[model samples]
Every structure is written in structure tokens, then in C-alpha cells.
Target chain A: DAGITQSPRHKVTETGTPVTLRCHQTENHRYMYWYRQDPGHGLRLIHYSYGVKDTDKGEVSDGYSVSRSKTEDFLLTLESATSSQTSVYFCAIRATNTDTQYFGPGTRLTVL
Target chain B: QKEVEQDPGPLSVPEGAIVSLNCTYSNSAFQYFMWYRQYSRKGPELLMYTYSSGNKEDGRFTAQVDKSSKYISLFIRDSQPSDSATYLCAMTDNAGGTSYGKLTFGQGTILTVHP
Candidate 1:
């Protein structure tokens, strides 16, 4: 739970359109992560922010970008949507005191 | 080769049966291991976490880590239908640099406990 919420629980967009998904957290945790889940590929990290204005690319960050302007908000944006980018996106927060990471409800996005 | 490997099993079992899920990794630097349970169409939630090599137990779940073999396992005793979900194994190193908060996960295994 970790007081995390993602906007646009479901969305559909055409190819080549820009799309942004927002993740908000109330826990004030220092670390936030974005991941996409697809069949046969459990969960792949897209991007993550360790602190405000600090971010890094992940294993599958080629087509995605992220930003953490504030401790409570992390954003993931697709410059141009693609069919391959269609997947369930999840946001997670890492606890400051422990190694545990908690996840928020996912956003299901589909591109035509 | 992928850093972490797990058999993606759509394993179906009867209620009250013992269930075992496993994952293996090639990175010797991995010192922290964890298991997450994700219900259908929902986000994953942490089910178990262990550091280095050892076993940790909570209620009906047991997480075992064998660092020597770079392997980990999650066992569910007296499984219930509600336990049906996808299980994912994730690992990270304590090296603490740019890799600090990064987690490598397996493809995950699906389990279904029938009543």
C-alpha cells in the first residue's frame, strides 16, 4: 500500500502520441521506481528516482523517461506511444529504514 | 544470460498442498533476496524478504536463500486458494553505488490453488 497511487488507471492512445503517467506517494520515501509488466516478462524496471531531481535508467529504459520533481511525485512519460509500449505500469517506493519496496495499483495502457 | 532465472510455472495444486517456488541468479554480488506476490490485474506486494544466506518465516510462508548456490526458494505450507498468484523473485547487491536501489527480477511463476 505505502500510500501510493497512479493516475489514469486505464488508458488508450494512438501510436506516436505522447502519454504521461503520474505516480504520487504520501510516504515521503526517498526512492521511487517505475516498472512495466507483460506476459512472459514479469516486471521490468523502466526508470527510478533515488531522490528529488535524481533519476537513472533501468534495463528497459530505451523508450521511456521519468522525472521526480518532488519527493512525493514521480512521472513517467512516453515521448511517442507504440504498440510495444502497451502494458501494465506500476510504481513502487523503497522504504528508507528497510530494503522493502511497496507497490501501488497499476495503470493499464493500450496503444493502437 | 539473464541475471535471474525462474521457471514460469502455471502450477495448479489442490488446497492444503505444499507449494514450492524457486529462482536462481548468476550474480554472486546479489546479497539481498525477496519474493513478491501479485494477484491478477493488480500490483505486486512484498511477501518475503531475506538478506544474504538464511531462512525467514512468517505465518504460512517461508523464504529460503542459499547464497552459496545463488539460489532462493519460497515455500507455502497448507496452501489456500487465496494464495493463488504470481510469485516474483528479486535480488540486489549491497555494493551501494549507482546500483543502490536497483532490483533485478525473474520472469515470475504463476500458481493456482484450487479449493
Candidate 2:
């Protein structure tokens, strides 16, 4: 509930197609994170950004990429979608003062 | 073994009952512990966070951490239907370096409070 929003709450794309998910935040937090949720795996971090033009790979960074050009927006892109990439993606923002991370509504993507 | 382990339960309980959820971790370096509540088709929301160990209470919720046992728990008193959701446990080491602020999470436990 930290003024975070993820676009295209739901999407379905065929395999080998490019897909992009957008996360926008109004809180102006310095840190933003992208995570994918799947059964038995809980939530796995995909990528994160600490500031403008600053980014880092997470535990499950394969087959995906991220960019942060502005403090309010972080983008996650899949160069080519795969069946294994079908899952719920969540965006989170961590305030500079606190260690807690607030999340966006999330996006559900499917690959055929 | 995974760094954090939790029972993925669809525990069902009646309203007003006390609910307990737990998570165990293999890493002793984790210093920051957190609990998040996630509803179906929605992202997770932070419920509680504690640093180091001991007990922290907030209204109907209480979070306990035992660093020695590498275990943590979240208790809900007088649970309500609105409290039905998947509870995820997460931890991190804030001691700096590249791992700072990076969280490792448990598989999560689903609880349903029926009215």
C-alpha cells in the first residue's frame, strides 16, 4: 500500500515473444525490487534497483532483465518469454529509513 | 536444503480462534526477520518486522524470534475472516556487502479463518 502500481495486471503471451512489465511508485523510495512468485518456491527476487541507473541481479535473474531510468519507475523485460517464465510478478519498494518492503498489486503472466 | 523452510499449510480455523504460524531457517547470519500477508491474486503486504530477537506485538499480531533455534513465529489472537491469507516469512542480513537488504523467504503457510 505504499503507492506502488504494476501495469498490465494480467497478460498472456506465446513462447519466444518479448514481454515487459512496468512498476511505478509514488512514494519516491530509493529502493525498488522485482520478484516472481511460484508454487513451492515462495517469492524469488529477479532484479532490483537502488537508485536511478543503478541495478543488480537477484537470485533468479536468468532469462530476464531490468532497468531503472527514474526513481519512480522500474521495468522488467523478458527478451523472449518461456513456459517457465509464467508466474506472478510483484514489485516492492523499500524506504530509506526502514527495512520493510511494501509491494504492488502484482502482475500475472502466462506463456503458451 | 533451502535457507528457509516453512510448512505450506492450508490450515483452516473458525473465526476468533488463535492462529500460530512458524518458519525455520538454516542461516545464522540473518539479523532481520519479517512476516508478510498475501491474499489470493494480490501481492504480499508487510505484517511485522523484527531485528535481532525477542517478541514484538502489534494489536492482534505477535512476532517471536529465537536466533538460537533459527526459528521464528507469528501469532494471531482472536483471528477474523479478514485475516485469511498466506503468511510468508522473510529474513535478511543487514551487515552490509552485496547481500544487504536482499531477503530470503520461506514457502509460506496459508490460513483460512471461517466465520
Candidate 3:
């Protein structure tokens, strides 16, 4: 509902292959986040972008990289996919004025 | 221990029952609190937000925060089947720098309201 959409709603890739997931927002939010959800582990932050060309690592940033060249788009890439990386990825936009975050539909990724 | 801890209950109750979900945190610096409801295969959606302490009510949902106890609770009155979903508690410290917009989340509690 935040005008956020994730590309490749679902993906399947073999281990050791590089994969990139995309998050697009229409509201022009300044802060965006990527999180991975796994059974029993809950949601863990992967990476986030506060502005164009600005990014930061999160709790579980290893094996993953992010780029925000534009305000509306943020990309998360797995240098080499692994079985441990299989999970549902969610994108969120933080409302600077409201101090709230809204989430996208999410992308389900599987690494064989 | 994890920063935030939740019961992670796969709780099931009859429709119209009052449902209580809770979370506890170890970090006292967390000032902003929020609740998110997520359905199967869907992303989480914000349900309620309360800053610091005290109670805030929104329709049939009530959120209570006790900063001193480092505990937060969500109460749903007259719960409906539509409310059956995983509830996640999230908090953040606006201390700026690395703590800017990062949120720490609970393990989430699964609820099922049966008709």
C-alpha cells in the first residue's frame, strides 16, 4: 500500500550463482530497507539505503550487497547464492515525517 | 539472549475471544514501538504504534507499553477470523547515526481465530 513493489516475486537459483532482487517505490521515500524472513528466526535486516548512492549494512549483511543509484529503486544482490540464503525477502520504505515503515508484497527466493 | 523476545505462540481460539500478544525487550534505549500483522505469504503491515509508554486504542485493538518493565502488549477485543495472522513487535531507538531507522523485531506470534 506504500506504492512499493518487488520484482521477480519468486525466484529459483542454483547455489554459487549470483542473484539480484529489486525493490521499487513510487512515493519517493528517502529510507528503504531489505529484510529476510525465515521460519522460527523471524525477520532479519539485510541492508538498507538512506538516499541515492548511500547504503549501509544491517545485522545479516554478509553474502549480500545493495545499491541505490536512484531514489525510487534499490537493489539487493547475493554475490553467490547459498542454501542458507533461501528465504522470503521483504522491502520496506520508511516515512521520515511519520516515523513509520511500510512493506512491499515480498519476494520468495530459493537456492538449490 | 536476543534483543527482543516474543512467545511465538501458535495460539488458537474461538472467534470473539480476546487475544493478548506480548513482547519483551532487553534494550532500554528503544523508544518507538510498533505492531505488525502478517498473513501467510504476505508482507507485514503496520497495525499499531505507541511511543515510550502508556496505552493507545484503535478500534478493537489496544496497545500498551511499559517502558519501566521493558514489556509491550497488544489486546484484540472481539477477535475475528480475519485477525488470524502472525503478529510481530518492532522497536527502534532514535539515537541517530547507526541507530537511525533500524528496527529490531521480535520472533512473532502466530494466531488463529476459529469460527
DockQ (C-alpha based) per candidate is: 0.61, 0.61, 0.57
RMSD of each: 1.4, 1.5, 1.4
Mark the regions of model 1 whose C-alpha exceeds 4 Å error after superposition. B95-99
- Please give the CA lDDT of all the candidate structures: 0.92, 0.93, 0.94
lDDT of candidate 3 at residue B50, scale 0 to 100: 88
How well is each residue in B33-73 modelled by candidate 1, as lDDT tens digits?
88999999889999999989999999999999998999999
iRMS (Å) per candidate: 2.2, 2.3, 2.4
Error of 2 at A78 (Å): 0.3
Judged by whole-model lDDT over C-alpha atoms, candidate 2 comes out at 0.93
- Candidates 1 and 3 compared: the better one by lDDT is 3
Q: How does residue B108 of candidate 2 score in lDDT?
A: 96
The lDDT-based order of candidates, best leading, equals 3, 2, 1
lDDT of 3 by residue, A13-95 (tens): 99999999999999988899999999888899999988999999999999999999999999999999999999999999998
Q: How far is B31's C-alpha from truth in model 1 (Å)?
A: 0.7
Q: TM-score winner among the candidates?
A: 3
The digit string of per-residue lDDT tens for model 1 on A8-108 reads: 99999999999999999997888899999998887898998989999988889988988888999999999999999999999999877566789999999
Candidate 3, residues B31-76, lDDT tens digits: the string is: 8899999999999999999889999999999999999999999999
DockQ for model 3?
0.57
Ten consecutive residues with minimal summed lDDT in candidate 1 chain B?
A: B93-102
